[model samples]
Target: MQATLMIYNGTAAPDADVLRTGGVPLAPARTTWPMCGNTCGGPMQFFAHLPVDYGVLSVFVCQNDPGACDTHDPVSGANRVLLFPSAELVPVAVPEEGVTLLPAVSAITTAVVTLEPEEADEDGLPPDAYDLARGGWKWEPGELFGKQREVLGSLGGSPSCLGDDRLPECPSCSGVMEFAAHLEEGIDRRSAMNLGGDLGYVFVCRPCSQGAFLRD
Candidate 1:
C-alpha cells in the first residue's frame, strides 16, 4: 500500500498553512469552541490542523478527563473532527478553562512511502495498511528502527486494526464516513494529543460537511 506519511518538522508558528499538531484552531466566524459533553463538561483540547484534499480537518479531544470522557468513541461527544473550508478561516477563541490546547505547536511535512504486507498469517490475512506503513517509516538511511516519535501520522490511508463494525456513520447524512487520516499522539509527550497509546482515526462525510474522530 502507498501512504503519505506526516513527518515532524519541528516547532512552528501557530497559524501557518502546513500540516501541524497543537495550535489554536482556525475556523469560520461564529464557530464556537467545542466542549467535552460526554463526561466532563470542559473545553475539548485543540489537537491538530490538517489540510486534506477536501478541506482543513480541525480536531479536538477531551483532556479534562481523558479516560472518563470516552474519547475513543466517534459519537461519544468526547472527541470531534470538523471539516472547515480552507479559506476565510480565523483563529478560534481559546477557552479560559480546562485543557484547551497542547503545550506546543509542531510543524509537519509529507513523504510518500510504499508499504508491503508481511507474510500472511495462518488465517492468510494480509497485514493492515496502516500498520505496515507506520512500521516501515524510515527517516534516515540504514536506520534499523524508525523514529516513531518523529512520525506525526499519515494521510489517505485505512484505519489500523479497526474492525469494520466500528466504522463511523455521518451524523448529518447517516452514511458511512470515508476514512481521512491516521493521527499519532505526536513527537513530544508533554505537547502531544493523548490517544491512550492507540492510533487516532479521522473520518469525513464530504457532502454533508461533517467529520468524526475516534481512536483504536
Candidate 2:
C-alpha cells in the first residue's frame, strides 16, 4: 500500500473536522514531502520527522551509485520508502536504502510532488511499502475487485452499509433509500478470490423502487 495520507498545514483549515452532511469525510488538504537535495559524502542533509509511513513525492538521485549524480536512473534512488515521524538522523546509501527516517511529519511548508502509486515488489519489503493509509484507514483501492476467492467481512455476509458514497438516486420517485442488506461473500480486486461475506444493501424508496447503492 502506498502512503497516500498526507500531512498538510492543518492549522485553521476545515480539515480539522468538517464532516459532509451525508457523513462522508472530505479529503483533507495536506503538505506532502518535498524533493530536498541529496546528501554530500562528507555532510549529510537531514529531513524533519513525519507522522506516519509516507512515500517519496519524487525520485531523484541514484541510490545505486551515490556518485552517479544522474536523477534519471532506476538505481536505488529510483525508489523510495515510508518514513516514521520519530526516526533519528541517519545517513542514507541510495543503493542500500532509498529512504531515511525522520522525527516528525514533514513541516507544513514542504513542497508537494507525485510518486508512482505502487512500488516494485521487493523480496523482503514490508506490505506497507506500497500501502498508503488514508487518515489511518487501511483499505485496498477498487483496483483488486474482480479476482475470485474465499469470503470474509460484511462484504456479502449480513447487511451493506448505506454509507457507501456512490449509490444512485431514482429519478421517477422522490424518496430516501438505504442499503438494507448485502450478499454473503466479499470480492477482493487482485486475487480473483471469493472473499466471502460480500454484503449487499437493500434500498427502497417510499414512493418507488428508486432505492439503490448507498454512498460510502
Task: Compute the lDDT of residue 22 as modeled in candidate 2.
Answer: 11
lDDT of 2 by residue, 55-146 (tens): 11111112223343322221212222122223232323222333322112211322222234554357653333212221123224665432
TM per prediction: 0.93, 0.19
**Candidate 1, 144: how far from true, in Å?**
5.1
- Single out the weakest 10-residue window by summed lDDT for candidate 1: 130-139
The whole-model lDDT of each prediction reads 0.86, 0.25
Per-residue lDDT of model 1, residues 1-216, tens digit only? 687888899888887767999879999999999988798889999999999878899999999976889988999999899999899999899988999989899999998877664677788776676666667676467887787777888888777778889999999889999999889988877668888898899999999999999988
Residue 91 Cα positional deviation in candidate 2, in Å, after optimal superposition: 72
Report the Cα lDDT for candidate 2: 0.25
Off by over 4 Å in 2: 1-164, 186-197, 213-216
